[model samples]
Each structure stands twice: as C-alpha cells, then as structure tokens.
Target: MGDLTFEDVTVRYGSRRRGVTAVDRVRLTVPAGAVVGLVGESGSGKSTLARAAVGLTPVTGGRILLGGRPLPRPGRAGPRPLQMVFQDPYSSLDPRMTVGESIAEAVARDVARGATARRAEVTRLLELVGLADERAERYPAELSGGQRQRVALARALAGRPEVIIADEITSALDVSIQGTVLNLVRDLRRRMRLSMLFISHNLAVVRYVSDIVAVMYLGRIVEYGPVDQVLGDPRHPYTRELLAAAPDLRAVGSDLAHVGSDVGDGTPTGSAIAVGADRVRIALADVEPADPHHPPSGCRFHPRCPIGPMVHPDREICRLTEPDPEPHQHRAACHFAATVETAPVTPARRSR
Candidate 1:
C-alpha cells in the first residue's frame, strides 16, 4: 500500500465547453495504510473520483498520484499498482466462468509461474477471503451475494495492488451480509495494511472503518479531516446538514408539528413554506442541486446554501464569490463556514 493523492484532480465528460464535470479540482489524500471514507449524495461524484483513480475514467485536468508518482497509462505490463472492487459483484464477476478461473486470470504470472502454482495461489486467495477452496470451482450464479463480493475482492488482491478503491462494495448486500463484508474489510486492512479509498453514502459505515473522511458535493470536496474531528465537530454547513438528517437524529430529539402555510392561493410554491417543521430539509434553500453542465456563477451551492443569500439577502458576497476549501484543522469549502452555527437563521412566517 502507498499514499494515494488526488492532486487538484478534475474529470470531465464531453467537450470542454459542453461537458459535465464529474470531479472538479478535488484535492484529497489517502495516506499509506489508511482507509479514507469518501461520502456524498448519489450524483456528487464520489464514484467518478474512484473510477478515475483506477483508470476506468479519464482525467480531464490535474493528476492522481500514487506514492507521489503519476499513475501509469492503462494497459501497461505486469500487475496493476491500483485495483478496484465495484459496487455490484454480480455484474463485476463473469457468470460464465468459475470463480477459480476468474481469480486465476488476475494472478500475476510472476506470482504463479505454473499451472499447479496458479491453482495453489487461487486456493490460498479463496481461503484468505474465508471461502473454501472447493467453492472456487463454482460459478457466480451458484454463490450467495456475499460470496461473489468476496471473490471480487480476492481477484483484486491477486494483482497485489498498492492501493485499493472500494466503491460502495457493501451497499448492495443485506444488512447482515454488509456487516460481514465490513468486518472482513477491517480485518484485511489490519492484516495487509492496504491503502483504500472507500466510497459510500452511509455515514455509519464510513465512521466505522475510516480514519479520515472527505465529503464531496456537486463534484467538489466540501470538507475533509480526521473522521472524529470532521464528523464529531463538523465545520462545513453541508456536513452539519448531513449529520442533522441522519436516521437516528430523531431518536434523541422531539418532532415538531408543521407550521406555516402556502403563501398564495393555497398552492405549494417554492416560497410558500415559510418555516419548515424541521431544519434538516435544507429549509432555507429547498432547491434541487444545480446542473453541473451549467453550474452557478459564484458558489456552486449558493442556490441551496442554508446560510447564504437564501437566508440573508444582504449577504450578497456568497452569490458573487466562490470559496476555496483552504486547508485547516477541519477543511471546508465555504465562506461563512465558521459562523454557520453562530448566526442561525430561524425562518419567519411569510406575511399573509
């Protein structure tokens, strides 16, 4: 395992002018032997970044570094320095081939020079992932969802990659099986000291195994730091909003009755709900995410910023200046990030 750095990496699709920017100048690092949890909404580009890291997607700008060296072009000789285990094991594995054959193909020739050596290596990998060597002879259709995922992981390890990118690897499994895969990942990291970029929207899953957490939004990394510091004492407003919306948040807090009504003709217009019963819905800025094809002029999040022009019309700065996520103890991409909690905006009822 080695240090994996996304150095101002930018990934775009289509022409420069009309293309969609999937990862926008994101800067983050996965320290050697550390598991970095990448969290964000579905369209926030977490997966795109992971795909770019493993050469599945092309980088439009900047570069990705492994151990401070540029990533080699794809289709090079020898074992891959980086490997990826995709979200769906069913699609990632070939249904036509036996798991043993699949895993054997991934084994570097140097690691297993002969037929017997390759067979032994395949068996060893199967046992390493808690699967019986005999099970390797079974097709993907013959195994459970969890077993297929385990085989996918074993195949990745066959390459002996320096860094592993696991993209929502367990989200597709049942909760019972999810824990098993997670525990296996934890144990594997401990046993192999593997550097991993673990992507998931599940905050609980991220908190359980990651030493560092980086939150992405609309193709940009909005916050990142030690998992404890970022999750425990979040500096970014987006991060706070995520924490407030956690499924268990209501377990400790009392629910409030709905207040305020539609402003005109009893129609539910965007501005009708003056004060939402709960703040977790991005109350002040209940708008859909801006299109990446044509992002906002200044802050990409201004249209949905809880503390920006949506709440304080006088705070025109947010609509005019894009903020960079400068490095800090708990880095965040926000202008009014520090004052987020101090200047809470309690929505007032709109005059009838």
Candidate 2:
C-alpha cells in the first residue's frame, strides 16, 4: 500500500468562468496504514475531494496519486485500489438487490469467479463486518441503519482497496448506532492496517480514529497536522473556534483537558476548549459564508476572523494579503498565525 496524495487539487462546477469552485487547490495525504480525518462545515468541499479521488467527480486541476502514480480511470480496472463508503446507506445500496448480491457484485473476478466462491466471499465479508451470514438474504430495508452502514463498508472492502474514503458515514445514524459503526472502523483499521480519509463534523470521533487531521473552511484547507498536535495545540483561529464549538469538549471542562486526555478512547471527559478560543454565538456565528464562486479578497476568512479587522483594526494585514499555509509543526493559513497561541480568548466581538 502507498500514500494517497492530492497535489493542488481543484474542482469547479458548471461553466469554468462563472461556476463555483467546490474544492480549491487542496494538498493532502493519507499515509499508508494511517487514518487522516477531514473536518469542516457543510459546504467545505470534503465530499467533493473524496469523490474526485475515486473518479466519481472530475478534477479541474492538479493530480491525485496513489503510490506516486495517477489514480486509474473508472472503467479501466482490476480490483479498485481505492474505494469510497458514502454517507447515506439507504441510497447507496440498491433496493432490488439482496445484501449478498450487492457485496458479490463488487467481488473481484479473481477472488470469486464461480457462484459458490462468490457466496463464500460474501459470507466472509458479512462476518468481517460483524454481520451474520444469513443476513445476506435480506433487502436493505430489512436491516437497521448501523447494519446497512456495515454492509456499505463490506461492499467497499469487496473491491480489495488499498485505501478507503468514508464520507460522513455516521452522520445519518442515531448516537447509539453511530458508536457501533465507529467501533467497527477502529477495529477494522487495527485488523487490516487500512489507510483512510475519514470525513466528519464530530471532533471527538475524529480524535478517536485519525492519526492526522485536516481542517477545512469553505473550499480550502485552513489547517492540518498530526491529530494530537493539531487538536491539542491548535494554531489556526478557525481550528480553535471549531474545537471550542464541540459539545464534547465544552462539556468536558476546559480546553487543556482535551490536550491531556480525550485522546480518542470514545469516553471524552470534557469538550469545550479554553485556550485561544472565542465562541462566536453572536459574532462569527451570524456572519454568512461568502460565495465560493467569488470568495472574499485577501484572506477568505478575514470577514469572520476573530483576530482580524473588526476585532483588531490595527491588524489589517489579513485584509490586504493572502497568507499561505505556514511551514511549521502545525500549519495554518493565517497572516497572524505566529501570534495565535498568544491570542486571548475574548468574548464574541461582532465580525464585520
């Protein structure tokens, strides 16, 4: 297995000149045998990046490499080296096919050419995901949400992939069911040494499973680094705000709490972060995100930034220049990133 690298990937939609750019010049990696978590808001383009990696979406620029080579085109295939498990299990699977048939269809020809072999493979895959062999005869509607998600994972594994992209796989499920699916993913990673790009809004879940974490805003990656360093010692204002907004962290007690404990064991003691954090209930919270087709000038985040312009008029560099992601232990795309660690956790000071 090799690293899955996205070098300056860009994805645009509709007319190139007038369309929206969903994913903008993203550079990320899912190292072999590691899980990289992608976290962001609703329109952050995490799903678009995942789709592009699997050829389900076209790239307008840059390259997606697997083991240092371009990913294979969709139809020109053997067993797919990369596979995606989509967010919605209900729509991802076909109602016409039984669970066995769905998993069997993705089975590599070499792995299961004959009918008996296919059945065995299906049974094995089912059991691999903690499902009973007999459940293969049931339709998708017959199973619960968690069970269906496991089936979706089982289908992705059927391709014998080197990497897996799980796009909000638990967002649609209840909390109880969500935990079971997360547990399965953690277990599978241990058993298979799977390389993954896990996308989600839940910071605690990401902390539990990811080795690396990449934070996105709008269509850009604003911060990224190892899980502990990135989450424990966030350098980006958006990352700090994101971490502070987490219910788990806020409830846990303080910011330093997550830094010491809450290292992905599922039982996070406290959630709200106190360091470099400023919860924007009335300020950044009310400001609408700018149009992706025509993002804000200079820094895309300046208008909502807690440390720029409205918050500190003297700090005008954020409005006059675009700061590239810094080269450091924890990278952040902010002109004042060097001072973020020292930035005080003030009350919401209305964003302009």
Candidate 3:
C-alpha cells in the first residue's frame, strides 16, 4: 500500500507574544492509490499540513510516515517518496529555464541519469502531461497558465513519487482550464497508481477529484469520511456547511447560498468536528486562549462560535472542559457533537 499517515501531528510557530498554532493535533490516514482532498480556508492550516507532508515545515509533535517509513525532519532530504505541486504555476517555475530543463532537473535529482537519458524521460513526461515535445523548448513566460501548470505537473512526476501532494494546483486557472488539469491528475493517478493529497478550498473541485474528503476548520480537521458519505450525506455541521456552499444543480432552490457567510463568521461552538468517521469533542467556552506560546485550554473554536443556540447534552461541561477526539463512524472534535445538527441554510438572493 502507498499509504500516507499522520499521527497526532501538531505544528506551532513564533514566541509567546506572537506565536500561532498553525496546525493542532491532527491524525489522518490516506490509503494508497486514493485521492484524498484536504479542504479549508486560507489560514485553516491546509497549506501548513501540505508543507509538513513534504518536509517543507517541521512537525512540532507527531510523526509522518510514507509506506510505513517515517519521513525525515524538516529542512532535511525527505524519503524521496513524496513530492509536491505548489499552487502558483507562475511563481513555482523558473523563468530562466525551459520547461524541459525544469523537468530534467527534478529527474536528475531523483534518478541518477545522464543528459541523454534525462532528455528522453523529459520528452516522455511532456507527452504524459499532454504537452508537446516542441513546447519543452519554450520558457514559462511563453506558455499559457494551463500549459505552465502542466509543466509543473510534469516536473513533480519526474521524481516518480508514490505520493504527491498538490496544494491548490488548479486555483489559479480559469474554470475551463481547471477541468483539464483535474482530468490530467485523475488520469495520472490511475495510470501511475499514485496516492495523492489534493488540497483545495473549492468543494466542487474536491468532490470531483477525491476518493475521500477531509474538512478542516481553524487548524484542525473537523470532519473526514469516504467522499460519498461526506459529500453526499455530510454528518457534521461543518461538513454540511461546506457541502451546502458547493455549487451544484441539485442545490437549486435550497438555502445553501448563505453558506459562505456562515463559515466566515469564525465562531467556535461546543461541538464535534469529524475526521474520517471519527469524532473529536471540543468545548468552546472552556478552550483556553491557545497558548500565546501554546494555547491548549478548552476549545480553540469557542471564541467565534455562532451555534450556541443549539443546546447539547454536555453544553455546560463542554463550554468549560476541553474535549478530545473520539473515534466514531467518522472522526470529529466537539463535546456535544452527537447532538449537533446541520444549521439551517438560507439561499442568497439574486438581484432583481
């Protein structure tokens, strides 16, 4: 199995006065040959987790393992089993190097190959990513956004990695172009049997590409499950909220339009957030101010919760005590998670 696993992973940055716990204790297992989508807003720690996976960021606590092997610490050479495709194609590529050369660099580093062999492999990669051999001679400045991204994909694949972490790889492309990249990734996954962690804020994209889905809030995963279970019948309030926000033909005439506004509120409710059929109970009122250095009191989510209206069995205690992640059919963190229901969604009004 090409599985990737994280056990109680936590990452904190800065000193007491200005520090932030970018990622809280998070545990996840991504099965081999599956595309798992990590969804969260800009500061929700999705990027942090992605960087940590490929050894770009340090793990303050916990461990990351690929195929049962622990990954090296940050700033060190990773196991060479994982590679990442960054969000911005424009910035990730070298303006000075041709697409062919960029791919060549990655291939050479991973595989001890001479110039001729690298060139041949680069040509094959270009074809695999749907780029023409002639396009390899072109520079990043000379290609379209989609083409540039394709080159980025080619470069990542050059390492022949078993696990690929694609962080917002298609966010910069037009909707039409995004589909092309998504299809390419889907194809590659099947052909190479590569396991991937596809991170994106766009639910539709996540649903389209993922075999399983993991939803993040603040710095922790709130809900995770098989794509069909999580996307088709989301159990957690947060998961329901995210699904409601996704644009879909089936969502017409529903109150889902207000999803954007609700999620942006940042209110921490004493409720459970799901993580792959497991539940984590957290009490908002009890959450201590996440340490100026560490911040591990009651519930980190209590500060901005809007669902206080819903009374739960452990509302009082949950409001005062820190809850831990409990294994459920799905995973979540919330003291009263079992009692919480999906909040009512209101559709956005169209201008007359």
Each candidate: RMSD: 9.9, 4.7, 7.7
Which 10 successive residues of model 1 have the least lDDT summed? Answer: 250-259
Clashing pairs in 2: 208-264, 248-271, 249-271, 249-272, 250-271, 250-272, 252-270, 252-271, 255-273, 255-274
Give me candidate 2's TM-score against the actual structure. 0.90
Q: Sum up the clashes in candidate 2.
A: 10
Candidate 1: stretches off by over 4 Å: 249-277, 280-285, 342-352
Task: Please provide, for model 1 over 1-352, each residue's C-alpha lDDT reduced to its tens digit, 9 standing for 90 to 100.
Answer: 4688888899989987788998989999999999999998888999999989888898988989888899988888877899999999989998999999999999999899999999999999998888999998899999999999999999999998988899999899886677678778877888999899999997666776688999988899989998777766676767766665554321111111011211112112222112222453646445877887988877778788777888889988888987988767678888887776522323333232
TM-score-best of 1 and 2:
2
Distance from true position, residue 72, model 2, in Å?
A: 0.3
Q: By lDDT, is 1 or 2 better?
A: 2
Which prediction has the highest lDDT against the true structure? 2
Task: State TM-scores per candidate.
Answer: 0.87, 0.90, 0.80
For model 3 the TM-score comes to 0.80
Of 1 and 3, the candidate ahead on lDDT is 1
Whole-model lDDT per candidate: 0.79, 0.83, 0.71
* Worst-scoring 10-residue span by lDDT in model 3: 263-272
Q: Candidate 3, residues 240-302: lDDT per residue as tens digits?
A: 545444444122212222222221212211121122221122333343333334543465554
Best by TM-score: 2
